[model samples]
Target chain A: MADAYESLTDHEDDARWAYGTGFSDPLAGVDTTVPSGIDHEDLAAYCLMLGDDALIMSHRLQQWVTRAPETEDELAIANIALDLLGQARLLLSRAAFVSGSGDEDSLAYLRPASQFRNVNLAARADADFAHLVARLLMFSSWRLALFDRLTGAADPVLSAIAAKGVKELTYHRDYAAQWVLRLGDGTEISRGRMRAAVGDLLGGSLVDELFAVHEVEERLAGVAVSPGGVKEEVLSVWGQVMRAATLAEGVGTTAPAGGRPPPGPPPPPPGGGGHDCAGGAFARAGSAFPRAGWA
Target chain B: MTSAAASTAATVAAGVADPEMPMLTLGDLGILRGVDEEPGRVIVTITPTYSGCPAMQTIRDDLTVALRAAGYREVEVRTVLTPAWTTDWITADGHDKLAAAGISPPGPAPRRAAGPVPLTLVPRASAISCPRCGSPETETITPFSATACRSLHRCTVCLEPFEHVKEI
Candidate 1:
């Protein structure tokens, strides 16, 4: 073993060591070729939004690090978070490179809440593991649709990121879906919890999805993910998944969220934990991705 | 053998399995970070397939051995864990290697999870030219591939669903 060390010690200017540093041509890369349409600035903003989602979600997932019910679950949550973090790092780094911002650290640590444009879905942490799965299933499917469209982004970098994310999202959705089915249909307690989780997690934050902040969407409309391209389809996918799981559990496909008409019109029922009891209310909007500090 | 080779020298590449997809090799995914050869030891540097990937240690072990077989005998592998890895690391050639293995090549999407890594429930055409047919007309069959680094895709013309190596 010492021989290996000594041998390596003699080899200065180690290319291998250099490779790990991620040094490379920022503009010219395998995924750098821009498609016919795409505004560089829009691409930058789009990347920032995506990076923020990953970074924030990863942060939430990290909270579950040692608090999981089982060892496997602990590792599973952590792993999932790590996956998101990895994506956030790359996306943010790419965003910084394009925007002339610093890097991932600056964006992740320095930015405040409102600056982050990620959907509330990612920003809101679940009250329980099952809630997490319910939220994850919906979020994953949406992302899959987005990534699928992004694969063809006008910008090579965006396209490349989407291409890879398509695969990861698929699994992320599937894993969450599986859990959704399992928990959603498992037992009375499990089902009740699943219902609560779904209700708690299913607040619509479509405004973020409907509008495109960066010009990238317009520039890469045909090539990169276009607004509204996969939204409906992905929603269908989630619905189908939820139905399938519900059917498997021998339960009605859709029931009033938690067996009651969600809080609408009228106000909370005097401190009964009603209305304000996490039925319709969701997270406050904020900035999850800021300019990165250092790469 | 030279003292460089014999003086407790060990070369090992972190053989970390890509976290998203555990089956493929880091080389296949193009995320084996770096293979460092130091005197008396070899240090393998690797970034997770996803920043939050569950199995970075395995990659480190694999990298360690890769170097050991090549030349060095002793090994010390470390996870760079910073700057992270991305689909950009998946080389054009590496994509082919993955495809040839029937493992699907990654593209367009950086195979590794990136910041706020966007997910896809729907897919549009990306520049993922089919590795088998070199046709850009490909569709994503499954957003998730058999493994994390790969997304299941089918060449429209070929009518075959193949694995695409994610750029991560």
Candidate 2:
């Protein structure tokens, strides 16, 4: 082994070490070509929406690092956060690549809160453990559904990223669901808190924004998975998890209005009219993409 | 440096052992992609097993020092993410090294077929043989372990708990 090491490392000139320092481009050899008919600017904006969501949520999860109830839980939450950070890194990089300006770090750190496009659910302040679990359950379910569809995307990079995300998000969703079950069925106080969390955090207008389609999503057509398309799948899975926990669907004090479109006609694409979210403000901006809704 | 010299440099870098799993070198783990020789610097490419692996910095530093000690003046390490690293890349020697170190090696990569399936309620344990007693009658203590690639398990025959390298 020492001989092998000597032979491999003895060169005076710059030679590749098995491992080296500095940043290596994760998408080094990936085919980053945007699909035909897909606008580069639209793709970049869409990536920001997805990447910002992960970046913000990862930060939230990081807040739990040393404060979790158990050492194992701390590690698990940290791992989940790291997973989201990884996804954010990739998506942000892709956005940079598409836009022809900025990089992952710039897009992530330099952007102001006003420029952020993540949903409101991800941006809220850290809540109690039950609230966090409830939020995670909903977020992971929705993201998993989106990623599952994104695996078939026309863009190879997006497809590859989604393929990897599916596994990680599966575990993430499972972790949150398990916690929901434990807390909801654990004790009277625990159950009450869990119930309040789901009703307060996930029940109202918060979820409605997740299903609203933006102009970027609509323009991408077959290239991007629309939030509205995955609404049923996301809701069904969430419903099953809640039912198993013995929590009533839509049991919050507030009416379950705003998040999802009513039984009638689909509201015009998010920027159409009377869309109260910040997304409308973004749409009014030079960019075709609408700003994402917040909590 | 000549092509032969570059290959030699890569071999040396590959020999550096992983800080977390010392028995297995980066080469054994298949993370050492290649070594490129430039005029004044050596660039090495590697892929991380997980995004937040704590050992990556250590491995990077170790590689730089190893090359410097071997007479190389400059070294640069690059980490990539695309074509994500998989457990299936562990070399045959790597598996043996893991087992000898009392860590059960991983099985094949998990199958990810298209379309949805029922959510997995119970955390599934891979059918891994115990490193201590080679016992098949083992049970998973937890789905997670100290590291992202491992899980806690105990051999039924030996009654000794051990770490199993989880299939990614």
TM-score of chain A in every predicted structure: 0.71, 0.79
- A240: Cα error in model 2, Å: 2.4
Chain B structural similarity (TM-score) per candidate: 0.63, 0.94
Q: How many clashing residue pairs appear in each of the predictions shown? A: 126, 14
**lDDT at A263, model 1:** 23
lDDT, residue B112, model 2: 68
Per-model TM against the reference: 0.55, 0.76
Q: After superposition, how far is residue A78 of candidate 1 from its true place, in Å?
A: 1.2
Q: Candidate 2 on A96-207: residue-level lDDT in tens?
A: 9999998888887777556778876665443467777878888999999998898788877787788778767887888898888888777776777677677766544668
Q: How many backbone clashes does candidate 1 have?
A: 126
Question: Chain A TM-score for model 1, please?
Answer: 0.71
Residue-level lDDT tens digits of model 1 in A1-295: 5766675555433333423323222222233333444565666677887877777676666666566666546655665676687678668877777777676677766765556656556666556677678767867777777776677555666665666566556667766777787777677667766766665554443334433334445554565455465656766666766675573342323453445433222222222323333222223443232122111
CA lDDT of A233 in candidate 1? 73
Candidate 2 ranges beyond 4 A from true positions: A1-37, A248-250, A253-295, B1-10, B32-45, B52-82, B125-130, B133-142, B154-161
Which structure among the candidates has the greatest TM-score? 2
